[model samples]
Target chain A: MSNPARAESIAQLERLVAALLAKGVVSEAELAAQQASTDRASPETGARMVARAWLDPEWRAMMLKNGTAAAEAMGVSMAGAPPLGVLEDTAKRHHVIVCTLCSCYPRAVLGYPPHWYKSFSYRSRVVREPRAVMAEWGSPVADDVELRVVDSTADYRWMVLPLRPAGTEGWTEDQLAALVTRDVLVGVALPKLPA
Target chain B: MNPRFSPGSRVLVKNDWPEERGPCHIRTPHYLRGRAGEVERVLGAFRNPEDLAFARPAETRVLYHVMFDQPGIFPADGKQPDKLLVEIFEHWLEAA
Candidate 1:
């Protein structure tokens, strides 16, 4: 499916990488490693964490209270990877996360943020316009809750575990896990009852 | 991109500077975008992530990865776009 346009995209990526290399902003080795990290355990670990948090209230509480500790508790260590952080959003105040300096995300806890998540529009606008962004994700205001935006930085990165949605009250942890969306885990959307 | 730049060039952002804005979608490290380096090399023919990310066919007009010194582009609040990769159109630059 790679036509001239697609070829152009690939070429652009090549030139961009070349530019980066000429500048030594990132080493060829590091860039190659990052480009190859797409298939590692980060996404698996991240998804598993969200799933587990849904099943265990204690673990969920731990994650909300302290992300690194909770991930470690779940056996998801960030030893060789970037640090991990968790931000929680509640009814009184909603939390939206962004890294305005770089895509410094908790790859150990959540996989690469969707390109849109780490965009100028998202980063630049979230803090100034949380309600608008959240609404787009279908996580609207409760009509009484305040909005709060959290900026994750280079030294630290964040992922949010949104408050559990209603509807399968007696459901097991596994059941709840099935309901959590990456957006929900990131507090961008709510996990409502299946439609 | 030049390794250095005249003072009148774009502001040079330090790598260690922290962003003050809340979570941003697009972030360029301050050091790259804010730092006013010379027009080191016009790496011709590439798509800016701003356009590429959005799949904007129109904005994909040849990207020139500009170079910067200690500081390039910096917002008053000290915010940085992703990688300091300013998706500037080539016309934005004026040779010094």
Candidate 2:
């Protein structure tokens, strides 16, 4: 059975869109084009960028310096999205991203955000107790290592360029890309060799 | 518009809330209000989200990357030595 509240919300949105369409505020074609663009992006795009960065030092430097340009170089369309900021994870420091206010993710590269990323608990708890939150994800940060929690509070969107794991030195980009997942890109988990 | 704050300079998030009452799109988080932090970078000018939310004629404002110590934000959390970076607009900041 359909949830009544959700159905009502959808109906309300449809009505609102219909009203806008009637007034020519937003055209149906424009909406379809936006959806198509959004559909074209996914975590694979980010994984490919990460894999390429791991293999090429210059590409890695560029990715660290300007994430949007790096993503564009990888053929990801940044079009109307906010500037992307790539946070590089090092041996002594780890970076995790959160939008304490809202789910402001790097949608141009990583596609849509997961449900957990928009949850109130994740938004509230992650900022106050990030180490604890990561531990819950089975990816605890070491006490000695510096943990930086990046809050995408305003215009900029962020993603983590996790350090490449060992034992994959001679791996091809495709093989390395397979190890990078959405959670890994978000810094909630680290990429590991297949068991 | 030029950026008011430079990288490495200290600034504080304004403790007061916007005069406008009721719900509004505010980028500055409540926890960061009144907190002191060092400017990490100048992110250039962007339209003020507060005005943009209402579809008003908005003016561009300089945004900044501010870094605050974890322990400083949460004093009771002890010496964790962690850091938190937030993207804050110029209007919400002042020289600390």
Candidate 3:
């Protein structure tokens, strides 16, 4: 059964869209095209980039230098989107991303953000107590590592380039990409070797 | 306009709370207001989002990547080796 409040919100949105369509402000084809583009986006695109970067030094350099160009080179359309910033995680430094003001994610690369990412609890707590928050998600950062919380509060959208897990040196690109889940790209979790 | 601050320059975020009628859109988070940090990079110029939100003719403003120590934002956290990075417009920042 659909929730009443959600159903009402959907109805309201539909009504608004219908009004816009009737006014010729937007066309059906345009809406369909937009939806198709959004549907084409997912975390797989980002995982592919990460897998390729891990295997190629030049690709990694380009990704670190310009994330938007890297994404476009990988066949992902970043037109009209804000510049994407790839935050590289290293041995001594770890990075986590948040948008305390709103849900400003790299939607073209990582798709829409998870529901929890948009919740008030996450937007408020992550910047304040990131370690405690990550621990709750079963990913803990050591005290020795410098944990940097990146706030995508303005124009630039951010995604994490997690350090490749050990023991996956000989793995194929497909295998390496499989290890990078959506949470890993967001920096809430790290990829690990299969148990 | 050219960027007013360069990378490695220490800057402070203004703590002003502008009052305006009707809908308002502010990109700077309240937690970062009044905090001091260093410019990590100059991210070029873009139209002022505050004006853009209202569909006004927005002026281009330089944006900066600012890095701050976590303990500086939260004093009770003690001297932890953690940091925070935020993208703040040049208008909201001043040389500290």
Candidate 4:
């Protein structure tokens, strides 16, 4: 079941795309290619970057300095995508991203924004009562830890580089990537060691 | 395009819109107007989205990573974090 307003909006978008295609402004092949590239990097792309950063200091530096470039270096196209800002979660600070106006996400790397991320409550309350909202996710940041809430209000989309969990000394990059779930990518939860 | 502010420079968001620019398809969020922040990074030049939204020739403008303190945005017994970053176009900023 879909809300009538949302269904109408989706229909309008489909019509617009169809018109663009009919006018040759966008070729069908081009449209398909762009759609494919839109999600070229799944959540695994973020995970791979984090895993590599954990293992390689230089790569970590690059990811911290310029997330878009770092993603491209990892063979992610990122063409026609907005600039990506990777917020590093550290011992002293934690990071969370929300677009108060709309769900502006780094889809090239993080795939699609989650459902709750686009909800009105999450968008509105996260900016005002981030701690309370975060607590609902069951990954509350300790009071001592400074929480940085990044609002992707413009063309810049943000993502979190979650801290590497302990007790995984000999874990391979693939294993580390496996630990990175959608929640971790969204900064609501942290990656954990396998039980 | 020459950017107004460089990375790491402090800047203030303009409280008011530019003269005679009718408000339609503006990208700068209302919450950030008149707010002060530091340019965390330079995002290079891009076609002005405000102009592009209206089907006009999109003049390029520099975009910056503007970082604001959470306390400054929301004060009084809140656990809202230390910083909030937003991407603002050069046109919306002035040297602090």
Candidate 5:
């Protein structure tokens, strides 16, 4: 309350809201008029990014080469995307992510990580044995697929750019986004598309 | 169950554990997180902001400063890309 910067932040918000009495900022009615918008990162964009890569080998190469730039080429803005580093899941190995210290995630690209990703159960064990974790999630992969682990720390945050699963011969990107759950991005679920 | 790491040891949190192996997690920031820091001149409770903010003087306990390589944590690959230090109970310590 005394710190100048923090005080300013709160003051500015108070001004924007006009006032805060017993109730807090109520945008329900106002938000409805303005057209409901997503608070979490847009999955539609992520699905498209994946779809484009799947359709174009060149783009796939670019994605592997430089994940951030590759994301931009697909029209997925990285503005405010966490210091995003992507882990590629190869046929021989799968990948999963956990933020043991805290819930540091690519909020801009993939949106908020599910609460479980931050829970001690996941943070503590995801690294100990990823295969078991994925199995619990219902999208277990072959033991052959190597399991790559990632830790999100102060400087970096990570997301899994899973290899495009076989199937969906002609599905649209919008449809694909529906299947791209946060769990998949975190490497818990390997996009269980209809193969 | 295998422990990711043991108490009181200086270790680097795997930046890309998913790309490699071992314990990993995004270090959240406080006064401390991921920095190559020291356990500080050991003694009694560490002073935390919450302790100061909430005025929980009675409940406050001694904590190590637990320095990190970098003074602070950021989003980039190397914003203060030094090392990390975190303070915890005695059991959290392992050989650095």
Candidate 6:
């Protein structure tokens, strides 16, 4: 941890955070709160909603229509965060979410985004060659299914409600929830039954 | 303020960047400029991030989630018919 390279990165991060604070872009308390909130919304929370939507048709409708309200109803406090949009995947359509500018994501429900999700390559490449990028991620879309790439360019963060895998009938919420991975929520991969 | 465009309105993103705003900071992506798309959702008026970046009082502008065709954006690379949705401010758009 005391290596020169590591020290340089640490210093860079410190400078960036300090600059943001000084510029009134974000406050210390707000940054701390966001960090704490990210800890609370793990993949489990995402799974919980996805599982609930899978079980209850009404909840699924609500989730697709307005994800911010759905997250609030599920007791996830997303105060000061932008509105959430849950893109439901169906037989005909698949959805993927990315932030071409800065990586704006549904951190309250899906936690922090992966490092790759914030990469410049991902931001530029995905928009141009979605199918190729998706295929590389191991989530190849079928020829018949239409792909929808959503860019988090403004004040709304987005997540994906992937299609429920087959053969999980009569499964408990916790069991089904476990299958809903963060990758699925980000649309980089899909949930699968146990092999 | 009443929004100029509603959901499903066909609009083209303004390609010009007003010189008065200067060139330091802008939220609208370069790839989306001049692209024709339909307003998928109307996000209410909010402080413009471009102005906010400079620590100035941001003038509120209506935002929209505009949906564009993949081919229209990346014609050569667009193998599959897909949709690309980007949020754009009302000022950066005009009825197509």
TM-score of each: 0.53, 0.94, 0.93, 0.88, 0.53, 0.88
lDDT tens digits by residue: candidate 3, A1-102: 222568788999999999999999999998898899888899999999999999999999999999999999988878888999899999988888988887
Cα RMSD (angstroms) for every candidate in the order listed: 14.2, 2.2, 2.3, 2.8, 14.2, 3.4
How are the candidates ranked when ordered by lDDT, highest leading? 3, 2, 6, 4, 1, 5
Write out fnat for all predictions, comma-separated: 0.04, 0.77, 0.77, 0.60, 0.08, 0.83
Residues B8-85, candidate 1: write the lDDT tens digits: 344333333323544322334433432344332233333344445555563433323333321123343222221122
lDDT of 5 by residue, A53-149 (tens): 6677887677666667866775655654434455666677565666666667766567656667767788766545555677799977674555555
Pick out the ten consecutive residues of candidate 6 chain A with the lowest summed lDDT: A1-10
- Highest DockQ scorer: 6
> What are the Cα lDDT values of the candidates?
0.54, 0.89, 0.89, 0.82, 0.53, 0.86
Model 1 chain B lowest lDDT segment of ten: B78-87
Preferred candidate (TM-score higher): 1 or 6: 6
Cα lDDT tens digits for candidate 1, A16-126: 989989999899898667656544535456556666676677877777667777767766645556445565556565556666655556666566677777778877766
lDDT per residue as tens, model 2, A104-182: 9988899989989998888887777888888899888899978889999888899999999999989999999999999
* Model 3: lDDT of residue A74: 84
Error of 6 at A186 (Å): 0.8
Which digits, one per residue and each the tens of the lDDT, describe model 4 over residues A67-155? 99998997888777788788898998888888887788888888877788899988777776778777888787788888877787677
* Number of the predicted model whose TM-score against the real structure is largest: 2
Docking class of 1: incorrect
Q: What digit string (tens of lDDT, one per residue) describes model 4 on residues B2-95?
A: 7778878999999976534765766666777899999988877888877887799988888888888877877752554567777888988989
Quote the positional error of residue B76 for candidate 6 in Å.
1.6
TM-score quality measure for candidate 2: 0.94
- Give the 10-residue window scoring lowest on summed lDDT in candidate 5 chain A: A31-40
